[model samples]
Target: MAVLRVSPAPVPAGRRQDRLSTARPPAKLQISAGAHAADPLLSLPDLPTPLKEKILCMEMMGIDSGRALSLNPALRSTPLDSLHVIISFLLTKGIHHKDLARIFGMCPAALTAEPRRDLAPVFNFLAAELAVPSAAFRRVINKCPRLLVCSVPDQLIPALVFLKRLGFKDMEGLAYHDPVLLASSVEKTLLPKLEFLEREVGEGKEMVVRCPALFTFSVENNLRPKLGYLVEEMGRDVAEVREFPQYFAFSLEKRIKPRHRAMEERGLRLSLPTMLKTTDHEFGLLLQTADSSPTVGP
Candidate 1:
């Protein structure tokens, strides 16, 4: 049999020098080329690959999530309209969680980080820019609301109050608090003010809130736990909150005990998850169980 002659495929002009070099290139260079060109899910400079992947994956999925795509530290610093646009985009995408990871670059563990994905930053940005009044926010959120994830009690209160102040009465579909944030800020004087805001807002609707359905005591310093006892207390009277099942946490820390107490009296429990769950059957609450020993403390 005749031997077949083999020849090397023609190399691109740009790659000839690379092929001639005997020294191995650095991993960083290889990664750069592989990531920038070959990998659509590559991470940018200064951000972890996971985070970069998380953000882009969410965006690629068209989820209307928040600013998971942004790289500038300064841009990340402010929750502005740009951030809102990003969030809205991600949310609208409604991408599946697993697909989100595959498209962007987030691991399952990273996706579980509630704080990093919290919408409070975006709300704060909206509140500042849109001047979301208590009544208007209530009205808008109530009309087409989205529930927030569970967080700390203290952290969640401020956002709830802010939403209330803006007219977002759809308490049934709001974000919850983070326990870590709550345990930190629970005992502060802000409790009374927060309660008061709720009462004041609820009173306008002719609804009576009977007990501090959502209450907290500082676990440490300013951190507070977003306790379910508060909602349980309110469930006694109000038609909506009376049957709420789970509890949630909040992001901001502001005291409003007197206000909270008053709302409780009206049967208006303000546990974000409880309200959301009551409104939408799908917006269920997830009460975190206590470990044998406290896993989290202020």
Candidate 2:
């Protein structure tokens, strides 16, 4: 080939830069120097950087970001010493990391609570006064972390006293099954619910202890209607209801009424739980089988 020199394409006047400027690239996220300085987390020199970042990341990614942000001021106000104390004390109480994360995530305010004033008293009360076992204490606190922040004398003590007076002898059962009961209003919630249950099934505390779940059911909607059907309409005794207090949990329209009607029409006798717990198709099949069976004259 002929040694012909080929010229390169000309660069546009504005585009050519032989030497690049030694300047920092513009930041994708612009934050003021004052903001970095004023951050409360940064002000605490003792706080581990990883922990600080974890808290901030958790707040940003929380289910309710606005609520998390609103809570940040409270969190920032908490002394690092207090936060550490709370965490350490909880760990000592046998709470696992996953449970602690879940509890703190749900009630972030608990992290800001004073370990001595807010948390220690509750733990002491649960362990010493209520005699809640370590494992049971962890379970209760995990289920109702709000209990950590509740007033020991005013709220927790009163509720426990009320339940005790109500003959709740199984403290372990209360702790594991319905620790939220400890946080409930004695006058407003617990008393009212107990009164309703007593009115329906007589003043036997054993019934309540047998079915602690009775406290969780709705009095007006579920309990009353179902009790009315079973006791008033079906003529089942309070003793029967007391034996199977879970009957109050069934849906009056969907389960109780339909099943009771089918059983009554077929003259079939079945336990309350069996009748209500079975599916509609199962109930229908039960009715068909009962009808097909020959009746023996007694």
Candidate 3:
């Protein structure tokens, strides 16, 4: 209901003792945001009172009411009080009022989700299992808003357990830096990547631990082409990769190919670090030095 609040009138000095005892705290008023209430979104003919309140509250919180409604149609049926409860629950979790716009804008369905059943468990897992301090909850949640929607037992825990079993040592690092990996599905996203490493790069299974960025790469797009060029084209042994797992971090088309071509043009066979670690000008200096006694590839 739309409320109109008024503060108590000033009491005369002589009657201060009598009136002050009866005076209560001033009533707080909450008005919806945006233009005048008579605007069409709010003033639509015969709009239900609860939904009107929901839209008003959403606008007041800086959320795009239209997008949030489309993303979570349940907003129409959910009570205004329930929406407030969800906001209050998130605030208790260290998500500030300023953070609400981005969070709700990204996962608008969150506004309608059950606070204790659906949401609280994720927070509990972060605090109890991942060891995320309550003060740092905002940092983790903001890093991956999907954490707000993912289930504790079903999605997050299984992935965390899998990463741990695979020798992931930094629990706090994963929670704080890569919570998306935890939010990901084990069967769909994480497992297939590990399986690929076990089958294809069997000798260097531990390389992923040495270089976690390998998880972000695609087998077909990045790993396959680079490995193919290294072995089939350049005739280099795969052990070079085991020695420097950061080999995968370089660009195949830009840095790797150009530098390899420079070495080949000079008919010089340099070590992987010799080829990859130097700056462009330094590599030019190396090539100049190599040109004097260039060795032919056999």
Query: What TM-score fits each model?
Result: 0.21, 0.67, 0.69
76-190 per-residue lDDT for model 1 (tens digits): 3333344345444444434333343332232222233333445454345335534544434333322222222324244455645544554444333332222122122333533
User: 165-249, model 2: which lDDT tens digit per residue?
Assistant: 8888887777777888888888887788888877767854676677777777767877777777887877777777787877776
TM-score winner, 1 or 2: 2
Give candidate 3's TM-score: 0.69
Full-model lDDT for every candidate: 0.36, 0.70, 0.80
> Of the candidates numbered 1 and 2, which has the greater lDDT value?
2
lDDT of 3 at 266: 86
Displacement of residue 20 (Cα, Å) in model 2 is 25
Q: Which ranges of candidate 1 are over 4 A from the true structure?
A: 1-52, 64-66, 69-146, 149-152, 155-298
Best-to-worst order by lDDT is 3, 2, 1
Flag the better candidate by TM-score, 2 or 3. Answer: 3
After superposing candidate 2, which stretches have Cα over 4 Å from the reference? Answer: 1-57, 60-64, 67-85, 231-239, 277-285, 294-298
Candidate 3 Cα outliers beyond 4 Å, as residue runs: 1-38, 41-81, 203-205, 266-298
Report the lDDT of model 2 for residue 198. 76
